[model samples]
Target: MAILMFISRVISLFLMVVLIFYKRKEPALLMAWLLLLVFLPPIGCVMYLLFERTPLPRKAGLFLNDIKDERRGRQASVSLNDKITSLVHFNENYNSSRLYLYQDFMYFADGKSKYQQLFKDIEGAKQSIHLQYFIIREDEVGRQLVQLLTEKAAQGVEVRLIFDSAGCFGTRLKYFASLMEAGGQVYQFHPPTFRLIGLNYNYRNHRKIVVIDGRIGYLGGMNIGNEYMSLDPKFSPWRDAHLRLVGDAVWELQHRFLKDYYMVCDHQEDERYIKDHLNHYFASPLSTTLCPMQIVSDGPDTTTDDIKLTFVKMIQSAVHTIQIQTPYFIPDSLFLETLKIAAYSGVKVEVMIPTIADHHYVYRTTTSFIKELREANIDVYFYKGFLHSKIIIIDEELCTIGSTNIDQRSFKINYEINAFIYDKTLTRQAVHQFQLDLENCLLVDDSYEQNKSAWIRFEEKVYRLVSMLL
Candidate 1:
């Protein structure tokens, strides 16, 4: 009995040391794990040991070595700065696609507009329509969208749909089958039947993308649900942006869609996706001078976390004021430092978030970060409405508007896509729109700083402790 007690003491001491020595990045999580181990004894200890150990892929050095070959080399080779000045900096270091094979144009500001446009595109499709989304509900919005997609498939549009297994789990299985039987090729990304897939639940396809006729494309944060359309009435209106590319970027989206399709369907599209000497797909003579843009996607398979790297580089390179509009502000240490540095360097840095959160705990975590940011001279604004837009305008020289958020889920967990535009005209247009939105926005001023309620202030302080994991 004494020996067992001694061994237990040794283990406890070791774990306590670990809790401090190896920073958890998220402090709230560390305390939770500590509590679990203290009360649950051997079982909690084992659980903590199994779960807390950083997964192989997330460990810093191991990840870099794994993708060292696929690093910036593959991406930096394709540069078109001569065609687009905004890409001048990126061009100096990277490469870009040689030529685009397809093009499509689309424009929608909100879910109602987007879905309505999506249905029309699907209905008009003659050859094929590829669709992918992070979430699709059986609610009014999902059912209505699915009904239209089914009819389009039945009409021989060759529709193919892919949904993340975990994301679509909330919807009925029968609904998925109905679409498949109606000629819609439905495949679940990382299906549960495969053990390799079940290994991690966090790596999800959080992208919402649609491609029709291999010509037109749509991609952004808008998922298939009533809440997104403001039709649910339960939540405030969904505010988001989606771009319709009419130039070579459409082919890049097509390539990504096919890549996801093949990744799940397990077949190479060598003949179809080949860089042909003959050039079959017609290029739209529409000069990219219109809105020269390229779609960049980041995922687990990629050589580097390009999306995260892209934002970090862009923020660091900002010459003018940086305006960030993110619904969630749970940034990692690197991003947090960049923002602080930006503010201290005389950049009029401003961030707008939601005053009332759609998600409870997440909002708590957000408040903690907001306080720190407010202290750092980063003007923080809380939209009275649900500000769901993920937008960034830096120096009026660069603007990124797309599905990617500035939270942990977007940066470290889910697959996301963003359109980095090099057009000064578009950046200014977006910046002006953002400023207009800020008019209705209330800044978290010195008033909130001076006398926030005890309960709210206490809650925010507690939330900050755990902001890393949130």
Candidate 2:
């Protein structure tokens, strides 16, 4: 046993040295890994081996180049406001995302309404339907969606789907057998050769996107599950945010979905065909409304944390107020500092988090940040129910809504997407929804952290030590 302990320490030291050299760019993450190795040598080394290696193809840029067309003309004219010009330029340069002028936008705060419109749109697909999700459970809601896709496929509309293997671990392929038999093409993102065990286990495609007939698109926080519809007693009255969009932005959504599909799908000939006929997958914009937004995406393949930087830019741009809602709040040092700096600069920073936890360790880590935020004069709200909305409204002129959470995993690890809307009308609507949500929350004050139980406080401290992994 002593010899085994010595060998473990030696191995841990070797990994620390290797990680320091390989991960010099990410100092914070490197430090976390090093600390983990020091504290729990054997288990930490195993985790580093399992999770650090990415299974994603390295030629992500080549795949992106295939989908883009410099020869194509812009479908909608866009004029950016001066206030958001820098933000727009940053997303454009970093993410290769163009500002799209969308004509229509609809926000859904519940699953019932979002699914109603989504199902209707799927039912109305004329040419094709592309759907991507992190999770598609083998439940009532999931079957209903599959049934709709199967019916659509049988009717001759092209149906395609890409689901993350890790996210749908328990869901059997037989569940989607009917859809596939009906001519629908389904692909799993980075499926392990053995069930639920692989190097790609840590990296997940957490994006939720649906593009129907290349005209309408749907994206945001809610996944396909009976729990999202509040059928599960554990998380009753689920609150989440989703968007239904029509105009040039839908084309961008289609592009993003196709990019993910290209990575997961093995048919090279089909990819070449899709690349050749891009216009068939992207319908011409008909709306003339002047709503400008950028669809930005980030993941492990990307060098920089584009979405996190985007969030920082949004936070820094705030001159009046910053209101944010997220289910998880384990933000890294930079993000936390930005919020504190914004609050210090006299911006009214308000953050709302759910009271119930879907993951215990993550929930505790989230609570650990409350004292720091409260001490910095930032207002924290404990939402009554499951608040799964990933939204941030700044200065009532700009807002971002999508799958991104204020956590390390969403910022740097998972494949995520968000829409940075630079329109006041929509921002105001989001702000209004946030204000309404405040009604069902308890505003944390000085005494809230002071009143924590010793055990709870200790758990929070311990969990926060490894918050980066969470």
Candidate 3:
């Protein structure tokens, strides 16, 4: 028995060494994993296997390989006014995402308005309706969505839905049974089978998108849940932002949905069947409006953090002011330092985060970061209500709104998508909304730190230490 125990210990130590050195993770993340592995060997190994050590889904890998040759020959041309050429070119070169000129834009600052518009669009769908969300609760909102999709499918309009398996864990299969019976296809991204366990829970599909007939697209922070509509008593008056876009930009959104749909449903025998049916969705008629936009996406599948780099570039290009709104504010070192540099360069930096705690660890980490920003003379606002909006406006010339948050999880882990809008008119509207939201926020200054007790400060330090994993 003694010899057997010694052998087990040696094997575990060897595994830990491999994990610590072989994985090319950030220093902070590596240290966090190392601490876990050393202090709690058995539990840490399970945690690492469940969360940190998985690759992209196998079907997604195969799909990417199949498209590699086709994508390599794809053109990088886009029609954009010279005013936004530099920024558009930067994104194009970074991720090969083409800039598209949209005809019209509708901004929804709350879920009620956004859902209303989305339902109307879905009701009017002619050929197809594609919907994807991180969360779809088994609540009234979710039922309504399923019923609508069922009706549309029964009417002979092709409908496809995708939801993150972990996000909708509690939702039973019966909830979507009726929709499937009506010929609507439903896929749960990264569903936990017995063989897979819950290994992919950390790498969620955080994107929220809906494309209708390949002509109208909606993308932003609002998920399909009653809580998002402020119907849940636990989180009433929910704040969020979503956009309804029409024109060539919708083509990009449709393309994204197609790729994700194919990846999720790649096991189907007729792989090219859906592709052929949806080929018409990519056709874009000429549009006259000049609202330039790019849909940027990133995930563990790709090594490059395109959205994070884009955020840094936006901050570096800001000349006068930077305004941001997000539910969470646990920024990584690079993002934090960029904001500090921008603030020190005579640029006004303003950030708004929710005062309420959705996740205790995240809330504590946010407070710590807010204190750091305050010390650097960067303005921080604690919103009175729960602010779930993810928005950023730079110099009233560029704006981004979507599921990506300014945090480590969003920057390096989860799958996220954002709309980079480069139009003065749309940007000014976003700026105006940010200013209005300031009315419900309390500014944090140097004195804010004085109220923290020694115990709370220590707790915050501990939380900040493990925030990268959070």
Candidate 4:
């Protein structure tokens, strides 16, 4: 048996190395895999088989994106060169759809108030409505919102909803039965089954978008739960921020919602959802002028990874400063390199991560980055309270705010969306809040190591290795 085990290990190791080279995965990661397979052949083979060569559901998600409308195909075919020429300061392709309707924008500073605004929006919806969330818990907050969605659907508002499968797995399936009964449609994105057993388990739909009457849209990191609203007994006084986007951007979010809707529900649009319901609020040359915002989304299906590319572009083009606040800070090699180079070049980079992480492992990895970043002269701030805001302010002119966090999961795995803003007023508006949050934060520079226990730092090092998967 021992001899046979050795023979099997040799065969698997040979195949794994051959496949890794053939696939052309990152050189460093491939080397790591080679080392892992040499020592732990069976486990490494399983990992590689499940991910790099798992030719089933993954292939399906890759080749089988929903068909875009004929209108969309035509629009997509057009060269955005004209739009690009006007927005020469920033990449024109990153600009938001000029025709997408968004009028006003509101910043929800308090997390709980986001839910309050949601309830009011639901109450006021006249016609069609679409709402999507990553985590739809069965807790107090979830039950209340579910009941409300049912009521709205019953009123013939064309209500539809969706949630992430893994995120809502613990919540009882029966809790949402009312939604179906009221002609409400709810579907889960990338539901985990026996088939999809791999590293991609972390790829979640992190977007929190609520579109009403094709008008008002809300999105950001805040999920639907009492913990987010401080109604959950487990966590208290939830602190987070969500953006209320009105005008042309709302349609883009609505378009995003429908894409997910089609993926999960496979339902066709109402024929005229766009004709009558769409309210394209384009920016004028002055009050609104080509504010050039793009609703960039990233996930497992695409190779480009829009959010990650956007980060790379912004970091590469940054002129003065970059401020980032995220719940989790587990970026891969390229992203980390970007930040290190920006800081090393004196770009006044500041990153605010929670002093105490919601996920303990995430917190550990974040501190490890802090130790390195502080060494490179980047400002690191720790918030005393739980910080759930996910935003980036660059050069006080370009800003990004949305549900996406700066982590591997958000960049390469999760179905996340963000609004990239170029307008100076919006940047200032977000930066003002960032400044206030900075006031509440404790800076860590030249002294973080002296205050920590050696054992704690050791734990952080161990956790940092797993951050790629976390």
Highest TM-score against the true fold, candidate: 2
Lowest-sum lDDT 10-residue window in model 2: 53-62
- Candidate 4: segments with Cα more than 4 A from true spot: 1-11, 49-102, 196-202, 231-237, 266-291
Candidate 4 C-alpha error for residue 327, in Å: 1.2
| lDDT per residue (tens digit) for residues 1-470 in model 1 | 77875676577667767777865445656666566556645655555443342332422222222222222111223444442444544533442422332333454557888878777777787767788988898888788878888888888777878888888888766786777888788888766542332234446787878877756777866788887777665467556666666555655666566666656774444333333311222223343334555567766555455676667777777766889888888887788889889888888898988765787777877777876787789999887777777888888766777778887768765667887776676678778767877886898877775686888878877666444432
Per-model TM values vs. the true structure: 0.78, 0.94, 0.91, 0.85
Candidates sorted by lDDT, best first: 2, 3, 4, 1
Clashes of each: 8, 0, 0, 13
Error of 1 at 216 (Å): 0.7
Off by over 4 Å in 1: 1-107, 191-198, 266-289, 453-458, 465-470
Q: Estimate the overall C-alpha local distance difference test score of candidate 3.
A: 0.80
Candidate lDDT scores, in order, read 0.67, 0.86, 0.80, 0.70
Give the better candidate number (1 or 4) by lDDT: 4
lDDT, candidate 3, 1-470, per-residue tens: 67855554565586668766776777877788778767766666666556663446534424533443332222344555554677787898998777666458899988878888888898999899999998898888788889999999999998999998877888876789989999998998878643343365567888998988877889999988888888877676678898998877777677677778776785675455655654446545435667878889888777788999989888888889999999988888888899899999999999999977888888888888877787778899988888999998988888999899988888877889999998888888888888888988899876778988998799799898777655
- Worst lDDT window (10 residues) for model 3? 65-74
**Of candidates 3 and 1, the better by lDDT:** 3
lDDT of 4 by residue, 150-194 (tens): 898889877787878778778766778988888887777777644
State the displacement of the C-alpha of residue 6, model 1, in Å, after optimal TM-score superposition.
Answer: 12
